[model samples]
Target: MNLSSSLMACLALAPLAQGARLSDRLESAHGRFLDDRRGAFTSLSDPFGVPPLAKIVLEDPRGRFSGPESWHRNVVSTVFWVGELPSENNPTPNTASAWDGNWQANFGGYDHPEKRDGFLPTGFVPALNPFYIALPYNDIGRDGRHRPEASTVIPWFWEDYRGEGISVCKDRWVAIHHEGRVCYAQWEDVGPFETDHFQYVFGKDAPRPNRNQNAGIDLSPAVRDFLGLRSGESVEWRFTHDREVPAGPWRDWSPEPGLPRR
Candidate 1:
């Protein structure tokens, strides 16, 4: 079957697999798996109930403190080109070039440096300590009803410093936040530390209170030269944590056979 047909099949079968309704299943599943115990700085809040784009602007100009609602509705919308659907009034872009143009117009001109002011917004106080923003994306799935391939994109943001620049890091763990709960796909072996330190490149254009080192790395000149990462090039750090695999669904998946479990 074609992709559309396959997706239709999945959607059709979704309601028949369990005793609960779809909404109930989703709520139950999310409740069982999501974690929300990080503290009062982590923005592990729900995004589904957020007001629509128009309503948000009208309701709160500064946004009621930075969180996933700000990230998805504002940041993602500002950065990515949300495509139009096929409807009576809208026509889809024909080629990748057309789409690229739309995307560029949507995000290219925004003052990213201004937006990167001190990680979270200035006035917004976090609700959880050791706050983390988990970004999860499907690397292998197409737009429609195909089973996603074995690929994952998991990035995290942790507040390690007490300054404006928020220290963002990439970990091997699959971080997920659903229904006010967070879940982590623990890695068998921790990966290298990858940090995102792009705020320092804009010179005076960079954000203020630049004394913090957690957000930006002080890499050696030789290493910087080797990587072709210029002074202002956006850089990110990645690191691994030492933790044993929990006995659960992922017990069999290991970095290697007979390797010491991290």
Candidate 2:
């Protein structure tokens, strides 16, 4: 997102006003640029004789967005812990992940957001990054066989795939947006309900119907706390490149056990 020169100029001078109704003052300053002549001052709203501010409209500078920003908007998300017990909606305990059998053991303990020690479970620090998420697609099937469409459906499957036992989707970064806050997390497991929904996960199709309020993704305790998200909430998410993920708590810990922080 880029800002116009006039709008940028007004925002750059926002700190000039310093009293009551701060938002109104800022708005007044912003309004000046929109209402007044191009690069010209009109009225004295403050001691500096600067015009009132104008409304700032955020937009793409090129009038069109790039193709890669395929965000899954307004998708229902649910909270799931590393060692969560089995529930009615989720029949399997999260102790064992679809990829890693020793998921809970590898994570160090149950990642209880309510009983936490700063984004991790109380008692022990996780061996890997606590910031994790589960999309509704697993490249590997339950029968210990890889999905036939995995290579074609997954965007970077060919470049990242190691072998049969390994998963390319595991540890993939995802950016989740709620309201105005954005939280980044790694893909560690699969399912709020369905997996193998390649159309929704990779293409333009929406999520499939499910019992858990049509949940499309599963968030970890760390991700939940970071975004201030409830168990059942709507959020927008998109797959993000590892290098593109900005420095945050999500990068504070290692993605692999014994490896350096990512």
Candidate 3:
């Protein structure tokens, strides 16, 4: 959605209170935030033009969309919830451990070959690069081998869109695998310009879960059919594994010619 429409929808959800001043500091921070890495692949014409971060404006007492609140003022206050894994190829332990605490706390958890010099910390690894750090989340502690389920809010960054040159927006919800790796998925809505609508670009060779090997598995077809998607449509998706059932028994649409209909 365009800025105006998005603003209108946010306003409708929670209106701004009277006399509330927009935080200049927050605005400045957002303006300076980098949307994508310098040399990352993307499909958008301007990868950096999108805001790397967004302030979550809560409704004011007056029920109007007005100014910034304390939550929005603190740049690091943004939070995201951990969703289920998307593929059967479970990530290794190293992948899941990285998302244990406040996402910002684990900034430098991963290692990379090409390092940039600047505001980023010396040991920092960009979470956007899934090959390095899997997903974004906060950890409770580092004592045990247990994988706990908890929700947290923290500063978030986006990866450069592959080939499209666009970057994922911080406002969107992301999926996190047990390995700590993360991926972006969009929600369904009325149209491309709708308030809840989002655009996403998936990487080639992305993993697909085999819930039912007998169902004739192919991620693209399953995802397309599951989301009621159209050709060339962009979407946000997340996968859930049903361990209770056998992988081969799952039913799915066939993409190949002469394949049995499921």
Candidate 4:
């Protein structure tokens, strides 16, 4: 269904401050789904009900995101794009991943650079990976379902949106809102931490173990740089449907078949 005239006006301009607070949006762009006819951000605070979006802070878990071994469930990055690697040392690692692996194809068909001796170049992982987006997912099934594995080589974490009957997708579009900049990126992967935390990502309640780390979302190097997020910085973001996405690197990059919904 189309947005109501008033809502459209609000979306075109700045969202109203009184619109139902989610994270920090003065006004969100919550619309009524044509299928279910349910308002996206319906809140009890709104007498008319249903605000647009929420402006809550997101987490850029770069430093404190720790784990035991390479496969140790908690220390991986959620993305695998090739870029300068960020480490937790006084000096930054002037290095990047040699390979940009595919998530759906099991990291298949990639040009792996030869490792310098047994030692990974300056600041890369043992497998020669410069960096990884540590997500809370372990799902390694080809069927697009959640299974949750712990192998760094498994390349398994993209969950089946349809498995849970949700609409999230790999490489899905998202709008990240910061101090005043609004950067756009694809949902390349899930998490800086806590993958199964559905309520935090989509539902009304905030993400878990938050208030401390306050990590609800993870951004890739590009996304983080675009939004200018500091390590462990908080920002607001919302999922943008395919139809609403604008054309950019996120839209024009390599063709993304994406994970099977069902």
TM-score of each: 0.17, 0.70, 0.14, 0.39
The clash tally of candidate 2 reads 10
Name the runs in model 3 displaced over 4 angstroms: 1-89, 93-135, 144-226, 229-262
Specify the highest-TM-score model's number: 2
**Candidate with the larger lDDT of 2 and 4:** 2
> What is the C-alpha lDDT profile of model 1 across 134-225, one tens digit per residue?
12221212332211222111112212222222112222332222234322232211001121212221111222233222222222222232
TM-score of 4: 0.39
The candidate that achieves the highest lDDT relative to the unseen native structure: 2
Off by over 4 Å in 2: 1-69, 255-262
Name the weakest run of 10 consecutive residues (lDDT summed) in model 3. 70-79
Model 3, range 32-130, lDDT digits (tens) per residue? 332223234466666658766678754222211122221111011101112213334332222222323343333334322123233122364333222
RMSD of 1: 28.2
lDDT of 2 by residue, 196-258 (tens): 899988877878998988889999888888899898899999887755678777776864633
**Tell me, what's the RMSD of every candidate?**
28.2, 21.3, 28.2, 22.7
Off by over 4 Å in 4: 1-168, 210-212, 254-262
Q: Residue by residue across 103-154, what tens digits does model 4's lDDT show?
A: 4133222212232223122333322121123233323333444334322122
Higher-scoring candidate on lDDT, 3 or 4: 4
lDDT of each: 0.27, 0.79, 0.25, 0.39
